[model samples]
Target: MDNCLFCKIARGEIPSRKVFEDEDVFAFHDINPARPLHILVIPKRHITSLATIADTDTLVLGRILAVANQLASENGSPDGFRVIINTGRIGQQEVQHLHAHIVGGPEPVGPMLKRV
Candidate 1:
């Protein structure tokens, strides 16, 4: 996990525009945002991806979701937001570490996905 980008960010080895941080979770603004309000919420402990999550990860995982609303409302997009967790290859996960992206703004984010 030493080399994992999100772990580095959680450990403060890398700088990020942090939105929220607690004993178990870390939320920060995405450096390259896809939406007007975009944030990345992650666990302080490294978990490869959602595909690799274990029962022991429940608490941390729950904590991630627990803080999403507050993080979004405080940062922006109080009306609503989208929480996305891209898993493995098929999910188009760009980062190896498990993280949920909170995206929204004054306007809708458009359709969840395009028709295949």
Candidate 2:
């Protein structure tokens, strides 16, 4: 996990435009915005991907979504928001650590497209 970008971000070893952080999670702005507002919500501990999550991770998973929700509402998109978790290679997970992408805004959001 030493090479994991998200882990580095979560650990504060690398700088990020952080929005929220607690004992369980770290949320920050995505370097590349897919929408008017884009943030990445990730667990403080390193978990490879969604496929790697165990049943005991349920609470943490819910916490991630809850953090995402609070962020969307607080950040000015009260009407709605999108939470995306890319699981593996085909899912376009550039980082190996599990993270959720929270995106929303007044502007129209686009469909998920494959990387070319």
Candidate 3:
């Protein structure tokens, strides 16, 4: 996992616009944002993807969701937001580490695009 980008971020080896962090999770602004308000929530542990999550990770996953909600409310998008977790190569998951993307605000209106 030494080459994993998110692991580096969670370990504070790389800088991020962090919005929240605790013993179990980390949330931060996405460098390549898809919406006006975009954030990435990730677990401190190195879980490859949702497909690989173990039963013990259930509570940690729940904690990540709760933290995402708190972040959305604090970031001025209390009304609603979208959370996404790309699972594999076909799902467009660039980073091997599991993470959730929180996006909200006016939906972008344009032609269908491959990239978010």
Candidate 4:
């Protein structure tokens, strides 16, 4: 994982505009945001993708979501926000790491919730 982008970000080797961080999770603004309030919430430990998550990883998964919730609430979208987890290449999992994309904006965000 030494050469991984997100791993580097988690280790602070690569600078990112961090929004939140804790013992198990880290969040930052997406470099290429699709929405005005786009942030990427990821785990400190690399898990490849959602397809690779194990039963033991459930706790971390929940923590990722909790962090996303807090981030969304803090970003002024307590009532509206989108949590997206792309699983594979077809789903646009550009980075080989488990991360949740939290998107919200002042405009109507309902259409961005289209199921993939």
**Model 4's TM-score against the true structure:** 0.92
lDDT of 1 by residue, 1-116 (tens): 78999999999999999989989999999999999999999999989998899899999988988899888888778999999999999999999999999999999999999999
Candidate whose lDDT is highest:
1
lDDT of 4 by residue, 81-104 (tens): 999999898888989999999999
- Misplaced by over 4 Å in model 1 are none
Model 2: pairs clashing at backbone N, Cα or C within 3 Å: none
lDDT winner, 2 or 4: 4
Q: Cα lDDT for residue 7, model 1?
A: 95
Clashing pairs in 4: none
**Top TM-score model:** 1
Which model is ahead, 1 or 4, in terms of TM-score?
1
Residue 16, candidate 3: alpha-carbon lDDT: 99
lDDT of 3: 0.89
Candidate 2 minimal-lDDT segment of 10 residues: 106-115
Ranking by TM-score: 1, 4, 2, 3
How do the residues 12-88 of candidate 2 rate in per-residue lDDT, one tens digit apiece?
89999999999999999999997888999999989899999999889889999999999999986888898999989
* Deviation from native of the Cα of residue 102 in model 2, angstroms: 0.3
Q: Which one wins by lDDT: 3 or 4? A: 4
